[model samples]
Target: MMGNVDIFEMMANRYDTPERIQISKATADAIRKYLVDTHDKNAIDFGCGTGLVGMNLLNDFNSMLFLDPSQKMIEQIKQKIDDFNIRNADTLCFDFEKESRTNLQADYIFMAQVLLHINDVELVLSRLYDILNVGGHLLIVDFNKNDEIVSDKVHNGFDQNNLTELMTKIGYREIQSKTFYFGSKLFMNHDASLFILDSRR
Candidate 1:
């Protein structure tokens, strides 16, 4: 199994900074546009660090499952759930890349600023595909391809077209993508642009 520990564990206590709150709000608003007939659906916020984006999107779904590998991050989400009496939300600490969860299922799955941290993109994408119910949507929000950045622990970014091709190979259909937000000091204080990719399982 992949080690779930990371810097997020240490940062969980102070992860929800004002800057992240603002970005999460914007990302949630953008994600809301593509969400349709979701009032009766269950959604999973994959790699939901402290539930920033998921918390903004609770009312749109029947229930929200905040999943992250970082236990501290999951604890943060649990505290928020308790603090707000958010009965429709829950948290789980598990790594999708570690194993396939045949019993787990959701009508919608979203990853906001989460994919870059994954070591194996295609593998995790396939794992998510298994977790989604047929006709359900997998929404990914992350930085677009950026060759300027270099990292061994994370991706520089992703090429949307290439991502679409990958999803198609994994049995996802009705794929679509759009550039949603841009910032000068995003992604480690470096200028970066973000995009959202929607694919159906």
Candidate 2:
């Protein structure tokens, strides 16, 4: 829908503020609980910005892929990887919505605060569903829909029940979701709540 590459590219350098790090830490903690054992599993943090969530959860997987359309954002993740001496992570600058990208299969796929930015939600969800290995899991963390937050480019947020129904339509099974965190000014400077949805392929 909206081209977020330019906006994210400009924010790449200063993206990791204390507030963001705290939020990522909370997200990582929630995800960690669902990971039974990830020593041999491969994970992808789709739309990962600066490796905040993926980096924090790196130890749970054998390999982690950071994908985003903004080169500057990828650059920031690379820098963090280097600074932290992280060896199990890789970066790819690809936009699944606009580009024909391939050869990416993961045991786990994590998306945090990303679904709202896309123009076509179902198409992107279908693409992501196709990229997972059989029996793999998809974890989506995003805001619950808010009528107060309005934007022409973004979807305000999503309703958990509606999102679950969409995932079901896309062929996901054993889907489970819950709201795990709440924050003030979390979305467009308005108070919003965050939820995590887990679905099996």
> For all candidates, what are the clash counts?
0, 0
| Per-prediction TM-score to the true structure, in the order listed | 0.97, 0.97
Question: Which 10 residues in a row give candidate 2 its minimum summed lDDT?
Answer: 95-104
Per-residue CA lDDT of candidate 2, range 92-140, in tens? Answer: 9999888655578999999999898888888888899889999999999
RMSD of 2: 1.0
The alpha-carbon deviation from the true structure for residue 198 of candidate 1, after best TM-score superposition, in angstroms, is 0.7
The sequence of per-residue lDDT tens digits that candidate 1 reaches over residues 23-134 is 9999999899999999999999999999999999999999999999999999999999989999999888998878877888999999999888888889999999998999
**Which pairs of residues collide in model 1?**
none
Which residues of candidate 1, in runs, are more than 4 Å off? 1-4
Clash-forming residue pairs, model 2: none
